[model samples]
Every structure is written in structure tokens, then in C-alpha cells.
Target: MPSMKEELDQSTTPPLCKTGCGFYVNKETRGLCSSCYKADVLKKKASSEVPKILDVNNNVGNQEPVENHDQSNKVVKKKNRCHVCNKHVGVVPFSCRCGESFCRLHRMPEKHACKFDFKAAGRVVIEKQNLLCVADKLEFRFFKWWELPDMVFQSYHGWENWLDGLRLKKEVKDYLEAKIARRKIV
Candidate 1:
């Protein structure tokens, strides 16, 4: 059996309490300080005396769920809901083609043709805003390569070309044509 001092020292060492709280606590309460030990005992004692239940009739100040007055009058504008499921959600590294925000499920499929920019040619280009594509008479906006983070731009030649065109302030074709050709097996 170790001496009481040795036992206390072992428990109060720095390694044991590296999580902000120091290790040395009152010996009577293991690792807890005297105040903490007293507080815990008091809380337990108070909880033990609480009544199990009470009649609702005796409570007069309670209220039911109230509907918000402003909420009823307000019309929520759906801003860039996901194209796949149309759910308004926030996810990082999101892809936007022609102003539509596509969640991961609907964006970037394994299909090579789908990955290419079909609307890259006729799509609208907003000088500082976006790059839009229209396919089958449906409009889609893809993220302009320039708008991407700088670190992301350094990764791909296609993106670099696309960004160069955008930065030069002239409209150029989307560089995803190779993927389209590959998909057609041409």
C-alpha cells in the first residue's frame, strides 16, 4: 500500500489535469476541489427532494405555443436552393453552374459528358458576377474559374485558361470540351 501523500501526489500531477483544470483536488473527494465536492453533494441532495409531478390546474402562468405575427406576413424568398432536391442547405465546396446551386448528389457525376460544359458557349457572362450556360433552352450558371479561391485556380490548366479569359475581360469557351469528346468516344 502506498502512503497517503504518494497517492495524493499521483492524482494531482499535471498530466492528470492537462485539460485546463489542475490535477490537485481535495484528498477527501478524489480529483474534485473542496468547493466542487460540496456543490455536487448539495445538488444531489436538492434533486432528491423534488416533487415527481404537479397538477396543471395549479399552474396559471404557463402558455401554449404561440405563432409568430411577423412570420405570417413575411414571404421567404428562396435563395439558391439546391437543384437536385430543392432543399435550402449549406455545404462547403459547393458548385454553381449558371447561378444554380447543386448539392453534391446532383453535381459532379461520374459521367464524362455530364462533367463537360455544354452551355459554355452561349451562356451569359456577368463581368464580375458569374458564367451562365443554357442547354436545351434551360439556363445554368457554372462557377467562373476566376471566382474560385487562388489555391484552387493553381491546380488545373483548364481552370487557368478559363480564368485567364475571364480576367482579360473577354468571354471564352468552357474548356470542358475534351470531356465531351471522350464521352462520345470520338
Candidate 2:
């Protein structure tokens, strides 16, 4: 059985690749032949890749390019050698917070002369994590029980056992108690 799209395509004269690749067009290839579409996609990917730092620096005055964080992460992942000594950091690479991977010898900031301010970064992290709550001072005025009115005492006093409740006969209490047994409100 043919799909709805295939059935519809069969009715039409069959669109060719926009690039004139002499092949039948389909939705998957985006109106292009499979090979042509793949080549196009690869070309687009290559063009979209982050420009080198040197190229970026050269073009700084002409136009400001958007910073890509994914490129930065990729650079870190690709760095298997120390930026300082150029030694290969095998297996477990010691990655510094300075956005550079280093060998065991030059892992420390002091060894590599890393310009990243550790104290400032730490301060910023602390500031973000430890939020200082700004609120009006709680005006909790302490009061003595004797100083309060009788109305306040009536509600709070003997809250569990209602002393002012209507007195029920012992037989009625037993019947209700049996029916409501083992049931808690919560």
C-alpha cells in the first residue's frame, strides 16, 4: 500500500531537484536528490561552524560576531594537551576552570600563569547561590497570657476536649464511637 504522500506524488509530474541534479524530489531530501541534499547539508554545516579566534580578532572592527558557547565546549573537549607545556594529557585530563585543559605538571593556575581571577569567580558563584533575603523586620511582639483577653483563652484552652459541647447520653456516645472507630480526619 502506498502512503498518502506517495499517492499524491504519483498524480503529479514528479518535481526535480531545485539544483537540477536530474533526480526525483522528495520531502526527506527537501526537493533535492539524496546525494545533492547531503552535499548541501555538509556545505551548510561547514559554513555555519565557528570562525577561528584569529579570524574573529581580524574581523572585530568590521562586524561583531555572536559568541558560541558550544564551540568553546568543543575546544575544551578537543584539548588533550597542555596549553603551557604542550604535553599530551592521556586518559584523565586535568581540566582547569580557566577554560583550558592542562597536563599534570601544569594543571595549577600558578604554573600556567592563568589570567582567570579565581577569587572573583568564587565570589560571583557565592553571590548567586547564597541569596540575601530582603524583608521587613519581623514585628513579633511578645505578650503575656494574663495580659490577653478572655476570648483568646476560650479558643486555645482545652482545644482537644470541647468542654462547652452538648452533653450526649452514654448509649449514644457508645454507638457513635463504634461507627467512627479507627478513623482520623487527616
Candidate 3:
């Protein structure tokens, strides 16, 4: 059976539910079945009432406004909250292998083997709960390989070593070249 997203993509006209119900995808929504939309509204209302953060008086309140925190003693200074997991991430939290700043829930194991390279030259995570979004994973893998340093990236067999023959960017590659040249002359 075709999923709703598949059906929507296939239809020339805007797709309606099989029940002939028109959906309000406009204003604060994507494609949502009527039942789901109502449920979402209710969920939002309930969630809005819940205190997301503590106020100055230590009472429940909405998200706190951003302010610089001075914590010189702590090893990890809490900076911002993770958007996905809603946990306080310390200053300069390591981006997940997925490029998402997941507090802990969505991040993969922090190991070299778990890292995936994205198609657009950046980092991404490999493992997941499901394989439904495989294309995204592949793109992310390519990105990581292209953008970040690989194992032994400083060595001759590094992936970007092929580009060694190409003209180097003076601003970016000059420092490394200088160090190498100095070592060779010594």
C-alpha cells in the first residue's frame, strides 16, 4: 500500500485523504490528516502548558532567554540546549555523527568506525533505528568524507592526497607546507 507521502508525491492535484477530507497544510503545518492535526493541536496545547525551563524564582516557565554563563571552574560549561533531545549541551558540544546536536538520545557511538561522511563534504552518523531514510544517510556519509580529516589524513595515503597535485590555496595550505619544508631542510 502507498503511504500518504508517496500518494501526495504521485498525485498531480493536491492529495486529499481517502475519506475525501481536505487538509489544512497552510499556516503552522505540513501535510497532516484531520485526525492527526487535531491530535497535534491538543498535544501542542498540553505541551505549551508544561514548564520547559525554570524561571528566576525557580518556578516553571517557558524557555529561558539566552545569556552568557560564566563558569570558570567547570570542565564543561553548559551553553545551549539541544534542539532534538532538549538537554543542556555544554559549550562547544560535539556535533553528532549525524550533524545534529543530539544531547544523547540521537547521537551514535563516539568512535572512528561510527563516523559517516556526507555527500556534501561534512559529518554524519551511520547507525539508526530504521533504514527508511537511507538516501539522507548516504549523502551524510559523502559529506563527512569530503569535509573532515579521515584516519591518517596527514599521511600520503589520505583520501585528499589525490588533490595534492592540484594548486594549493596559499591561505589554507601554506602553514603545513612551511612546516614540511622546514623539516626537510633540517
Where is model 1 poorest over a 10-residue stretch in terms of lDDT?
A: 168-177
Per-residue lDDT for 41 in model 1? 88
lDDT of 3 by residue, 65-167 (tens): 6665668855963436664557776776557545456455545544323455554342223334334554434333323323344444556464345446545
Please report the candidate that would top lDDT against the real structure.
2
Stretches of candidate 1 exceeding 4 Å from the true structure: 1-20, 54-186
Across residues 1-186, which tens digit of lDDT does each residue of candidate 1 receive? 999999998876734322335554655675576666677789999999886565677654675644548666888655556656776657453455444556666655432124446455435444336745646421135544333565664555545464455553233343334433454321
Q: What is the lDDT for 158 in model 2? A: 43
TM-score winner: 2
Ranking by lDDT: 2, 1, 3
lDDT of each candidate versus the true structure: 0.54, 0.70, 0.53
Q: Tell me, what's the RMSD of every candidate?
A: 23.7, 14.1, 28.1
**Candidate 3, RMSD to the unseen true structure:** 28.1
Model 2 lDDT, residue 46, Cα: 93
